[model samples]
Target: MNKTERLLAIVMELQRSKLQTADELAEVLGVSVRTIYRDMMALSEAGVPIIGETGLGYSLMEGYFLPPISFTVDEAVSLLLGTEFIEKRFDPTFRKSARSSRRKIEAILSRPIREETDRIQGSIRLLQKDEMVLMMREKVNLGIIREAMTEDKKLRFTYHKRVAEADGNRVTVRTVSPYGLAHDEQNGWLLLASCDLREDIRHFRVSRMSDLTVTEDTFQTPDNFDLQAYRPKDTRSTQVCAIFNPEIADKVEEANSYYMETAESKEDGYHVTFRVREPEELLSWILGWGADVVVTEPESFINRVREEIGKMKEHY
Candidate 1:
């Protein structure tokens, strides 16, 4: 590692432990006592909390924290996997942040930890197409939205939304407080905000927003504004069953925790059941699975699928 990397790593190691003697730090870092003193001075100059006494070595202050670190084997693997996923699956700005975070992590670890991160990164397979153009645009939009969210500022924008029919002209809306940003499988980016005129939780497509401006007028977020409540929940109380081919079963099982109890091994495939809140959401998921899954129950859902197929055929 370079000098800067070594210094950063030393600081991280020292921060993780209680007060250590200069001798201890020097021994761990494989450097002489004089070199340790030099490093300590450099750290202190860099605004690092390296307090020490004549006999006692040094310790980081309580409030002092490193950017973020992964020490455990599992944690290292998880970080690598999560970073890889973000880089592959998220829009451009998110991917850049993920890469930057990963670099910061690697700069602080020892050789062994670095090797572990490398191994995990190399072994993990994120099977998704890289949407570079979308990623880049989304990254810029996300940054602006995130800043506005943190500053608790009102936003002004010309938002376009379909009125009555899918082919209808877009309606322009002037909105206010943006509560949060959420991801929709079919919709891409959805901005959860309170419409100034309607005064309700309204979802707006981020891609459709134009002439966006962050206003100085700040607004209060609802105390009861729970993201969990806003998120799509299982609407169907009745159990709906489906059979998943082996290829898709493994992927589906890994993606959702609720399936653990419902998945059963069949002679040729895996049988699964779950409560679905929206048939549309479930249908989208089923379509993504292609021929790997078969819907077996809830005749209404099956009928809805047929109706959708008819509509699709009409379009074709």
Candidate 2:
């Protein structure tokens, strides 16, 4: 980091804690001990009110406060946009907090920065399309789920699945120990939890949940569970490859199908590979591109594509 940024970081670090040794500060800031000593000298010269004992760590003098920090246009806009997102996607409690936070941020900004941020935000839009109504409907459930997780309590809900069973039942009652919440641009909010029925970890879409309630039962979170590093394993094994016309290769890439594995450009076209649990999973997506794409792998999938095309021809 630049000297100016490092100085600001040092002030923030010291303000947050009671005592910080030069060695500890060096480790935290990823700088050499000598560099830290130099920074300390600079800070002292600048009259930062830092008190350093010979053996003890350095600390800010009690009751001393730093002035408001300056922010660039990009930094201000990023923080403001974050508050806007939380106000839109989160529950009422957090929505109120987000509004308050936005006002506080705006209150602290200089007039010129505030005007520029408003102009930039005016040109940008955050739209959730058809998911807005669903998210609003499930907003209450999000608060309940959060409370359950905070209190280490179990949760009960009726979940709707995307696919139905042989008996044509698409809904089931579930009790789960909530672990974390995840948001995907395409999938909306999902709850990662340990299901009592499945006896394993599962992801349940919040929008597809109903009659959600917190239970009296409680549980402890496993020590190894880390929400940031966790990724659900993909188990789909069936492989299929398709060649796409160069004219629409960029469009195919933009679609970003979950099963898409690889894309290679050849003389004929862009060859795309997909791994799916079933060929049917890829049928509609391949058909969406029409003449722009041609299936070339898995004779079985080729036959299925032909069958679908034949059925389409019958309509014409």
Candidate 3:
């Protein structure tokens, strides 16, 4: 990366991490330790609110923010795609802000690049599936939950969960201390919270909530609660082995390798294994690939695939 990109990345790194050593930053950004020191000095000179400690490494001061800076075409496109995601799934209040932010980003770029970005943005479209569309229509007020989280207040709500089409569904009341929120392609918006009902941390699909109430009661976030570490670890998952066609190798690793455990070269192609949370979720992904991938898994997964196919045929 060039100096400008590296500088921006340095600022981003400091923002994401409360503290980082020069060695750690060099490893993450793929540069030498000396180069990291030089960049840190340059960023400090440029009035980035970077503070250093003798043994503790460097950090951005609390509440310090980088001013509007230039973005490369790829960076601009990335922001545009994220803004599109927000506009599509979030409430009208947030959607308006997303639109305005995109407009501001475009306004800052030069005309030629702006036109280029517009064309690239035009080629992008997000398909809101029926479930997500329904969620957006009956959307819970995320802003209220956000406020409650800010104030460390408890939230009470009835959550709806459906296990099977024929089995119907269940709604149960829950009081939770909101930790944070995350978005996924599968689950859309999810609220990560510590549930008093479950006596543990649970991920609640925000859209499936009803009769929502932010309580006057407040609680402190556990010092042990780390949102990044809260995600289910692969160590606790079942191992799934597969052979993937080489044609989609790059695409698969880039976009679909989150659950992957290990990948090895093979005579025919690449052999891989992923530690997955559930057979159903991983099976859906494998079936989406059709013949491009084949699963050689524990018989349990194979049986699930067979049963799902049987259901599909019976439905048809």
Candidate 4:
């Protein structure tokens, strides 16, 4: 059990009993006496009114109880939304715990509040397909990646890079010190880490990787490693324009860059303008759309695409 669950359990145990010794509490909770002592200290710090005597043991202060916590309408709705997202987005342990917690929250909510929350939930929805599927279908274990990140350990994986050529992708083995995970609007969950092969920071699409294994070796994050700084930035941003297939109009909005204004639709499809990232990155995205999309402005971007296509043809 995690610290949160243990703390809740401790409170419940105390509420039901008159007085409990540290040894008795430790035995019942399946934790060490030292842990119980630490928990008691923590509870006291949180103003739990846990009174202890030299010989008598521990008990709640007479007539004192753990106070009821309350949430405002917006706060409750926001929590429900988060719970729903976690239950849908995550798998296994995370999903299970979130489901249980959601149920607990629902049980405590007043009827009127619960009804409003239900209405809000019904109105909001996320998809497993479209953009989400690109990241959701991870051939690798997410838990393993999480463990590696948490332990600050090294990871070795066979990464499949999405190649432009008809010959398909090039697979390579990479061993890197795990730094953090980033979820890109276009790419899904990306592992941002120090790459030993490249001798620099690189982001790998977690869904595009396979044969992941955590190493016993530990690593220290660089002192200068700031995620915001690690991403390349240009003083002047590129104005990227593209047309999406009307069938996947939602995806146009999904791919909107941070600097992009709202996507506008013509009769054909959604017209997207992104004050986008570097030229190379934008080119890759346009190519990924294949025949379904086309770039309009920036004659320079059009020429680069033509050049890249020629190279791809040469490769084949």
The local distance difference test score of each candidate is 0.70, 0.85, 0.77, 0.74
What's the ranking of the predictions by TM-score, best on top? 2, 4, 3, 1
Position 247, candidate 3: lDDT:
80
Question: Mind giving the per-residue lDDT tens digits that candidate 2 earns over 109-170?
Answer: 56577689889999999985555675655577789999999999999999987656446778
Q: How accurate is candidate 4 locally (lDDT)?
A: 0.74
Q: Mind giving the per-residue lDDT tens digits that candidate 3 earns over 209-267?
A: 88788999999998988888787423336788888898877767866555677887687
Evaluated at residue 277, the lDDT of candidate 4 is: 44
Best-to-worst ranking by lDDT: 2, 3, 4, 1
Candidate with the larger lDDT of 1 and 4: 4
Candidate maximizing TM-score: 2
Off by over 4 Å in 1: 1-70, 84-97, 127-132, 160-167, 184-187, 232-316
Q: What lDDT does model 1 reach?
A: 0.70
RMSD per model, one decimal: 10.6, 13.9, 16.6, 10.4
Model 3 poorest ten-residue lDDT run:
161-170
* Model 4 spans with C-alpha error above 4 angstroms: 1-67, 130-136, 164-169, 226-316
